[model samples]
Structure formats: structure tokens, C-alpha cells
Target: MLAIVSVTSPIFLLIALGFAAVRAGWIPREGALAMGRYALSFALPALLFNTLSQRPLDQIIVPAFLFAYVGGSLIAYALGLTAAAVARRTHPLDNAFFGMGVSMSNSGYLGYALISQILGAEALIAVAMSILTEVLLILPLTLILAELHDRRGRHGLARTLGKVVFQVVRNPIMLAIAAGLLFAALGWRLPALLGRTVDMLAGSAAAVALFAIGGTLAGQRLQHGLGPALAIAAGKLLIHPAAVLLMLFLVPAFDPTLTQAALILSGLPMVTIFPLLAQRYGLGELCASALLITTLLSFFTLNLGLWILGS
Candidate 1:
């Protein structure tokens, strides 16, 4: 238990520091968001490019991990959506966003930061696989549900999903992945100065991303939506990780390191953009409160998860 705390303490402390800065007005909300954008668009992309470009194709592609993680996430999605459907007579559209909030992990910012601390460079590989599952499967599923519900049979789900795929392909991280794969395939290397620059940027990616997550979560009010918010947070912090762990066991023969990575990633709170995504459906307040609660509670839940995994 002490060892687990030793690994997770610095990570959460930095997050708390970022939260304190924003709430205390040391940094404005917009500035914090800008920090997130810089990390995602610049620092994280650089990191992905470096890791992907240098590693052989076999190391980066883990089919078993994808199957296990995606399957578990969908289980979470189904459960969250079902819970939403049974409560307060919400439209299926709103429920889709609820499902999304349950299923999507904060793979971009928090995932790498948490994993890298525990597993060192192995985080690069683990997080890469986890992000792919979110982008390729979980996100697309949520958008599809929303579109199908909104259009009420006017729009084809397949067509809507295709458009979502195109947009996802153009995401900054996905673009980085593509570029890195191209470089790896061609055996290309950048000039020395450019290489050094990328290395420096990559090094900053984890810390800045973690801080940005904390900043984005600041100032979310915790009233008026406590019931459903608490339910969603509980689902995210407990059911999601348990599902992933179960799926990993059923799948069999995965590397233990990647298996641990899958469990930790699943145990994370929902992506920070969860509220923004729900804002489109008018559920932002609920989602934001849920995000706050889940993140605050994760400090303890994650400790429990680490202990159970090790035990």
C-alpha cells in the first residue's frame, strides 16, 4: 500500500495543485484550457510521434488489449445508458451522452501521466493502445447513438459513423500516429535540431497534460445534480475497471504489464471533455458535477485498485 501511494501521490498532488491555482484565480479558466490545448496539440503529439516512430510495428499494435479494453468499455456504456434510460424520463439522446461519460477514460491527459509513473517507458505503449480503443471504438459508438436518437430514422447510422470516423482520423493525436507510422515504415529520421526539439516537447507532455486536466476540472459546482452525478461517478470509478479486469482475464495470455495498464486506464475518471460533449445535449451541469466527484474520489479508489491488483 505504501508503495502504491509512493507511485500515485506525486501525480495526484500535481493535479491538486492545478485545481488550486484555477480555483484561487492564480490562473484563469481560459488560460488553463489553453494549457490543455497546447499539451494535446503540441506536447502530446510530439511524444506520440517520437514513441511511434522509434518502435517497431509489432510493439505498438496489441490486438488482445484492444479487444479486452473495448469490450469492457462497451459493457460500461450499456450499463450507464440503461441506468439513464430508467431515470427521469431522459431522451435516448441525453442518455447516449451519459453512456459516453461512463465509457470514455481520460486517455489523453491522465492516462499517460498515471501509467508512465508506474511503468516508465512502458506507459508509452500501454497508453497508445488505450487511446486507439477510445478513438476507434468508444467515441464512435457514442456519436452514433446520439445521431440515431436525434434523427429518429432520418439519418443513417452508418453514414453518421463514417463522418465521425473521418473527423477522428483528423484529430491531432491520430495525425501524430499516422505521421509516426509513416516515418517508421520509411526509416526516416529528422535533422538533429528538430529531433532535439521534439524530444524536449515530448518530455513535457505528461506533466502539462496532467496539470491541464486538473485545471479543466476546477470550478465545477457540486449541487442540484448530486443524485445522478454520484451514480455516474460511482459507475466510472468502480464498474468500468472491474469490467476491464474481467475481460482481460477472459481473454487470456496478454502480457501482464499491458494487463495492468488496461486495468489502471479503465479505473481513471471519464475524459475531461465529457461535460463539453454533454453540453451539446444540455446535460453539461450533471456531467461536470459527476466529473468533479469522480476525480476527487479516484484518489482513494485508485489506491484500492492498485492494492487489489498487487494483492
Candidate 2:
């Protein structure tokens, strides 16, 4: 528990401090957005390429891990939607963001740090699992849900899915993952110079992204709608993990590492992308508030999981 706190608290504090500095005008907000774009477009792709290309195929290709992780995420989506219905949330975009807040996690930045600290370097494979599931699987579904719920016009659904496909195709990280997998399958390796270049950029992605995530949340409008945001946060940090554990129990895998990792990862705070996706799809307020609340509350839930697992 102490180890979990020791590792996660400092990272979040640094993020919070960055947000506070930005909010106070010590760091220009525009500059932070620029940093975020660089991280997403350049640094993150490099990181994904470096990580995926070098990781063992067995780790990345585990069927059981995929089943547990992806299944857990789907269950989270259903649970979030159900909870929103019970709460009488009728706004389509808000509910979509609410559902995203439940299923999506800060897998790359926050998950990597916490899992590595608690579970060692081996945990990177689990992070890889999360990235693959999130980027390839859950993200597309969220976009589809957003479109179906969109009532802007008759063509809104087409526009929503079209933009989603375009963005997915354009995503550097997704491209890197696809390229790296192909290379891995064909047993090809990048030149040492290119590999080193990737390493340099990849090293900077996590911390920068975390800081930007904090800055993004610092500017949120959490004051207006507390109930739905907390409801979403509860689903993300608490209910999601519980659902994953239940799934794991029902399946009863021979090895527990993947199951354990998936459950813990599911319990994490909403990803920084929540607000971005919400803004793009029109659920900015809900996404922003959920991001802030979950980020703050994850300390307790994460530590509790660590205590249970690490014990």
C-alpha cells in the first residue's frame, strides 16, 4: 500500500502542480496544449513503436489476457450505461462521456507508472494489453455509441463515425502499433539509429502527457454538475474493477497475473483522452468533471487494490 502511494502520489502531485501553475497563468495554457499535441502525435507514437517492437510476441499475443481485459471493458460500458439510465441522465452526449469515463483508463501514463512500481518491469506487457484493447477495441465502440446517441441531425451518426475512422487512421500511436506488429510477425528489426531515436522521444511521453492531463482537468467546470460526474467516477474507479474481478472469477484462468493486472488496471482513473473525446463528441463538461474526480479518488481505490494483491 505504501509503495503504491509512494509511487502514484508523487506523479499525480507533479501533474496537479503543473495544472495549478497553468491555471495561475505561470505556464501559458496554449503552450500546454502544444505540449499535449506533441506528446500525442510524436512522443507517444515513438514510445508505442519502441515498446511494441521490442516486447516479446508471447506477452502481446496472450489470448486469456485479451479476453479478460476486453471483456472487462465491455462489461464496464454496459454497467455505466445502466447506471446512467437509473440516474435518469437523458443527454446522449453526456451519457456517452459518462460511459467512456467508466471504461477508458489512463493506461499509458498512469497505468505504466503504477504497475511498473508495484509489479516490476514485467507489468509493461499488461500496459501493452491495455493499450491494444483500449485503442483498437473500446475506443471504436465509444465512438459508435456517441454517434448513435447523437441527435444533432440526420447525418450526425455518419459524421461521427467518419471522423472517428479518420482520427484512428491518422493516429500515430495506432500506426506505430500496426507497423510494429507487422515487424514482429516478420521478425524484422529497426536500424539501431532509428531505435535510439524512438527511445529518446518515447522516454518523454509519459510525464508530459500526465502533466497535460492535469492541466486539462484544472480548467474543468466541475461546479455546475456534481451528481452525474461523481456517478461516472464511481463507475470508473469502483464498479468497473468489481465487474472485472467477477468476470475473472467466472472464467477461472490458470494464471492469475493477467487477471489481476486487468482488474487493477480497470480500477484506474479515466484517461486524459476522456475530455478530448468528450470535447470532440460534445460532452465536455461531464468528461472534465469525471476526469478530475476520478484522478483525485484513484489514490484510495488503487492503494486498496495494491494492498489486496501485494499482501
Candidate 3:
């Protein structure tokens, strides 16, 4: 229990401080968006490359963990959409936002911290996979859903595929993953100067991200759609983890390290990025509020999930 609090509290405290700063005008509101861009475009990708390139590909590609993480996300996304439709009277954009809020987690940030505390650095491969699943697989689908919601002129199936391809190509995390894989395949290592530089930048990612998340929470207000926001939070903290555990039986066993990693990753609350997506794409206030709610509730839910797994 102390381990949990020790790790989780510092991260949350930074977030809380960031939020208070934003509220008190100590930090400009615009700074959060810029920090977010740095996280998405540079820092996170550097971290992904450093982490994954160091892992043994054969051992890291655990089919069971993949199934649990990816399959659970798909199920949770669908359930969130269905719940939104039935309970919130939300429009397509709203539905997509709520679904994303529930299904997409802060896996890379929170997962790294929690798993490192309870598991260890050797579990880093599982954390890398968690990030890959969340950033690569789940994120694109959510973007497509948002596009579909906005009626962004689907030229054809091929065109839609092309756009997704373009988006993937443009995504820094995907690019880093691809580059890392290529280097790994060739048994290449980064030069010392470049590698150390990347290591330094990557190390700053979690702290900046947590601070930005808090700033985001400070900026959020439930200007509309409380019902959907609450529903999204419930889906994230409750249904998503439940889906993961339910699917765990169908999959093969991961190593204990990976198993613990998966549990912690799966139970993370909504990513701080969701609200940025909502605001950028015109999804609306409920989306951000949903994110805030899920993040705040995650302290309890993550502890419960870890206890269940450990027991």
C-alpha cells in the first residue's frame, strides 16, 4: 500500500500543482498545449524508441498480453459507445469522445510508474507494449471515429485507408517504434552522444506529461453532458478493467512481470490527450470533463485493480 501511494502520489501532486498554477495564472494556459505537443511529437517517441529497442523482441512479443490489452480495449470501446448511445442522448462526436475517454488510458505514463514500483525495470518491455497498443492501435481508430463523427468527407474506403496511413506516418510514436524496430532488426545501436541525449529528453516525459494533465484538468468544466461524462468515467475505471480480466482467461499466461504490467496498464484512467483531441476536433466540453473524472477516480480504481491482481 505504501508503494502504491509513494508512486501515485508524487505524480498526482505534480498534476495538482500544475492545475493550481494554471488556475492562479502562474502558468499561461497556452503552455499546456505546447507541452502536450512536445510530449506527443518528441519526448514520448524518444522514450518508446529507447525502451523498445532495448527489449528482446522474441520475449517481449507475448501473444497473451497482446490479446488481453488489444482485445480488452476493443470490447471496452464498443461498450462505451453503446452506453453513450443508450444513456446520454449524445451525438456521434460525443459518443466517439466518450468511447475514447473510457477505452484509451494513460497507460504509458501511469503504467510505467506503477509497474516500476510493484514489478521492476525488467518489466519495461511490457510497458512498451502497453504504450504501443494504446498509442498505435487504439488511437488511430479513435481518430477515425472522430473524423467520421465530424462528417469529414470520406472520399472512399481507399481514401479513408490512405488518411489513416498518412496519420500513422506522421505520428512520432509510430515513427519511433518503426525506427526502433528497424534498428533492432539490424542489430544496430545508437551512438553514445545521440543515445544519451535521447535518454535525457525521454526521462523528462512523464513529469511534463503529468503536469500537463493537471493543467488540463484545471481547464476542464462540465459545460455540458454530465450524464455522458459520468458514464465515460465509469467505463474507464470499471468496465475497461473488467473486460481485461474477463479476457485474461482466454489468453495464454504472460510472465509474472508482464502479467502485473498488463493489470496496471489496463486499469489506468483516460489519457490526458483525450480532451485535447476533443477540443481540437470539436468534440466538446463533456469529453474533457470525462477525462478529468476518470483521472481523478483512477487512484482508487488502480489500487483496487492491483490488489485484486496481487491477491
The candidate that wins on TM-score is: 1
Which candidate, 2 or 3, would have the higher TM-score against the true structure?
3
Give the TM-score (vs. native) of candidate 3.
0.92
Q: What TM-scores do the predictions have?
A: 0.93, 0.91, 0.92
lDDT of 1 by residue, 127-166 (tens): 8877788887888888778777773454586788788889
Q: Candidate 1: where are CA atoms >4 Å away?
A: 151-159
Q: Write the per-residue lDDT of candidate 2 for residues 241-298, one digit (tens) a residue.
A: 8877777766647456656678778999987878777776666776787788888888
Candidate 1 structure lDDT: 0.85
**Which stretches of model 3 miss by more than 4 angstroms?**
151-155
CA lDDT, every prediction? Answer: 0.85, 0.76, 0.77
Runs with alpha carbons beyond 4 Å of true place in candidate 2:
156-162, 252-255, 280-282
* lDDT of predicted model 3: 0.77
Candidate 3: residue 184 lDDT (0-100) = 68
Clashing pairs in model 3, backbone N/Cα/C closer than 3 A: none
Worst-scoring 10-residue span by lDDT in model 3: 151-160
